[model samples]
Target: MCDWNVDPEPSKEKKGRLARARGNLARRHSERLLAELYAGGTLRARRDASAVLAFAVALVVHALTLAVTAGGIWFIVRGWGGWGMVPGALLLALGWSLRPRFRQLPKDTPVLRRAEAPELFALVDEVAGTRGVDTIVVNDWINAGVGSYGVRGRRLLVLGLPLWEILSPQQRIALLGHEMGHYVNGDTRHGLVVAAAYRSLITWHYYFEPGEHDPLDEAATLQLIVDLLYVVPRLLVLGVLTLLDRLSMRASQRAEYLADRVAAQAASTRAALEWMDRMLILDSAAVTLGREVNRTSLNRPRGKQQTDAWAKGLWERLAADLASVPEREHERLRRVGALRAHSVDSTHPPTHLRHACLQIGEATPPAVVIDDERDRRIAEELADARTKVALQILQDGY
Candidate 1:
């Protein structure tokens, strides 16, 4: 396990108190998670609401379509029950589309044997211990290759690539603290509950229809009609779900704050902040480069001769017309497009805001724990890459 020498000046009593407080919070969070998971009725209610809303709207649409086709208001009531089949088809499609992602709890024991880093395991044990919960498994494979901080099997996965390339030991500790916070707080169960609710919503119309309407019915035309009628209700439900997801994200972000506090309590606030910054930097770099690499591979130069000719002519023109332009000006021209893209579509609410949240009330200037020299160099490199990208955008007039 990795070792740290805490500042001896801070009394052991204070550390003990913070540890106790952190444990209490983790326990409360874990309990809440378990409650949410086991509370299937609540999820059923949400699902029922979605199904009823979709069916009612679709049923109305079907009635209107029949009324218009027959060209008589009196026929609407006579054939209204006939339109129930349309809602049924939509219900079937919805059920299929919104099926729960996982059927059973994922196990993590097998993943632990493959994990290479001893330090990460130690950190995980420490965080789990603080919550008074013993983890059955820690997954090693899923860390950097996919999204971070997700629950899978019975194991908590800390991606190896992200840990190895992006984080220092302190940052690694903070990252582990974040994941453990999710586990301790019962994020996995809440996630499953939400998924189940969504699934149940899709299947709701089947139960409410007047006659037996099969969601698994094979009639293409009937299904299409139902699908068309269900579109509005589907959109409405999706919009609401999107809002809920955003709310969940907000809650998750706050949980991140608590986790950071936990990590800081065990270690240092400065360490927590440093880890956050590094994660942002590494993630930004990965997204940018990963996009470009994927694009390049997919767009392998199919027309080499024509491209070469165009490139040669463009270079000659640039050399002749912009020879005296400064490197900074060229760089600015390249990145203008990427800057616009970042501004409009970025999911994260600015890095500085995240950093500020972590440093709510600490000493005058927070204690430094990591290597400033190396971090600055990495930052400079990333900035330079961004500058080049900006210049490319500018030259392209994007």
Candidate 2:
């Protein structure tokens, strides 16, 4: 039977080779920059006045957008003819859409208040130093982050319960120290001007990005014209993005290194090292957790699914799964990270470089410690949310 309806997808490995080049370049750049900074024997990066160029470019982007927006208004007002209004409307729509937007915490994220988790807040306040955290939130994932959100730039802390459950108390403090470090270190990539400019270029690139189109489709010749028109603009947007990235990224990577230093200082060298070890096994941990959940769900009746002990025992099983991974596997993971200069994302430097940098520095004792009594008390505060998250994970089939 001939399957004329089927079109086998292109090989991902083949496509990835070409498509991943840009990311590969960025990673190499990160490695080089980290090496250079470390060679200077300084953990902290001094402010670079040259960052003003990035800010200037950002202003230019905003000015261009405003000019286009004004031109759109002029076109509509003059209305060269009745149908002349069409181009005006299109231009207006595009210019307006390209404007930067304020970030807000996701609606699905569960927000925790100080009253609800005072002990958790105390730990956060101590680690954060000045205590500007506006809200704390939790989710089911195995990651955590801190970010500014809302018009006033209120700080939001995201705690991933799965990862939190696996971490020791000091490791938890280390994690908090790292995130708070981003803010205190003053990572310039997140600054309003450069960040907004970068955002505009990304949007522009998306609008002009080329894609496969059928020649036999309606108005195919017009589509070809459109594709041709997109090429130059798309290239320009890409070039600008590259420029902005080059200007802002060095500072960002330095921030990451500095944050690691802060983590070590706050939670002790041992705790920070253990924290890094956990990072290396994140992929394996996620896979094991997923397998466990799937196995638990298998052949279990929907009605009786609620009777499952997910809330009571999922974390224990997950921790055991991670603990069982061989030390040789951990070494292998480190080698892989070193080979590729692995990072959590384009925004971070290579994780292995970070870990190695910490090892060579002086060992420090933890400034803050969470004792058994306090740890248990914090857990008591988290009991309701913990059970709810576990039930939700089970019901939602994660």
For TM-score, the strongest prediction is: 2
The digit string of per-residue lDDT tens for model 1 on 82-155 reads 87545555544544554445533235222332234333344456655543222223222213311223345344
lDDT of each: 0.41, 0.77
Off by over 4 Å in 2: 1-29, 32-40, 215-219, 301-309
The local lDDT score (0 to 100) that residue 8 gets in candidate 1 is 23
In model 2, state the lDDT of residue 296.
63
Query: Tens-digit lDDT track for model 2 on 14-43?
Result: 323322544565566567766765686565
Scored against the true structure, residue 69 in model 1 reaches a CA lDDT of 43
